[model samples]
Target: MRRDHPMPCPDRHDALAELALGTLAGQERSDVLAHVARCHACALELSELSRITDDLLQLAPAASPPVGFELRVVERVLACSTSAPTGRPRRRKRHRLASWRPAAVAALLAAVVGTGAGLLAASTTAGKAPPAASRPVTLSASLARHGRVFGHVRVSSGRTPWLFVTVDDLTGPGSRTVICEVTLVDGTTAKLGRFRLSQGYGSWGVPLAAPADSLRRALLVGTDGSVLASARI
Candidate 1:
């Protein structure tokens, strides 16, 4: 049915599938989101694809392959090679299906550990600085939708107050780099820094000027000027 909407491109379909399967990376995922947000047809397609994926996940894998199925497959291949006029064709499967399971597992583990580490790091800093004594500051923030976290904010025990930012969850690898600015309550904005976040959570420390009164309402702003979060300490 030719509605008023434009059909999504084939590439978008493939991108959507890869993203749904947690395979797309780098520019690919970005391209998918950009397209999906603008195209109603693609958005609908993505919805259906997500539902199909959920259904597939609910379905259990066959307990076992049919008896002798592997043998039969090997035999068929041998028969084809033997029946060929020329010697067994040397053509190789040009592309292979990559398994992201191992990498994903590693990432999941890192996220678990990172979350704990982040909490630990935040805790260790507690009471260490006088400014932090008033209220505990939390460094929690959301990665802008379609955005990536790259670097760590530097926080060291010294006269300066520092806040560290970490990338806990992201859509792609650690390649995505984002520039962020930190704002103090006094209306002073500092371009803290830029960093790349690969797969799991990443940490960075940002040095702050003295006079911790402004730390209460401190905020982390992304490149797009979105307030990721406020410091709890």
Candidate 2:
């Protein structure tokens, strides 16, 4: 039998967040990986946070000014100077300066508009949900064989549901293709996907159509039709 680890401690959760953000490295990274392997709640949290991180990256990529923007500003300033009035030297100088003034003002306004637009977009996205609701509910279960724990199954719930499986400490083969199947409440089994394990260690995740709570159990099967491990949800 395997002991159930409690939900993430503050330090653990902070580590998980850093891991998801791709900022954790060195000994700290290795420690978090080892801990997540055995901690169900922390693993689920990491998975959810990872998905949120991915979405954020996709939604807000790096921003830059439009192409040739600087060149266009220079052209406008040059055009204003070239078209300056030439009747009187002093008056021409004043007119040239006045012409440059409009160009500078236009350039400033363009910059202000670009910055305001970016701010508005960020605010709109942030307004969609409260900070507390950013992390969705994720569920987990232990996979075992003959009363000995071997792996874990995690399900994330939100607009996009996901099924994540991790296997460690399995014996018998160096490499094998494992099939992930889920049993619904009505006794129906659905094969989510398959992944290869290297020396009894690997992790895989796939988007799921059914909600997380609808699953009754998760199973890991070998290509040879042998039941490797099973987890009750």
Best-matching candidate per lDDT: 2
For candidate 1, write residues 35-90 as lDDT tens digits.
88988889877776778888887797767742223322333344345445476643
lDDT of 2 at 106: 33
lDDT of 2 by residue, 63-162 (tens): 7653333433453445445664443222111122223333333333333322312322332322233212234466677889998978777666554455
Q: Judge candidate 2 against the unseen true structure and give its global Cα lDDT, from 0 to 1.
A: 0.63
Ten-residue segment with the worst summed lDDT in candidate 1? 92-101
Q: How far in Å is the alpha carbon of 233 misplaced in model 1?
A: 5.3
Give the CA lDDT, 0 to 100, for residue 160 in model 1. Answer: 33
Looking at model 2, residue 229 earns an lDDT score of: 95
TM-score on alpha carbons, each prediction: 0.30, 0.42
State each model's C-alpha RMSD to the native: 24.4, 32.7
lDDT of each: 0.46, 0.63
Please give the lDDT score for candidate 1.
0.46
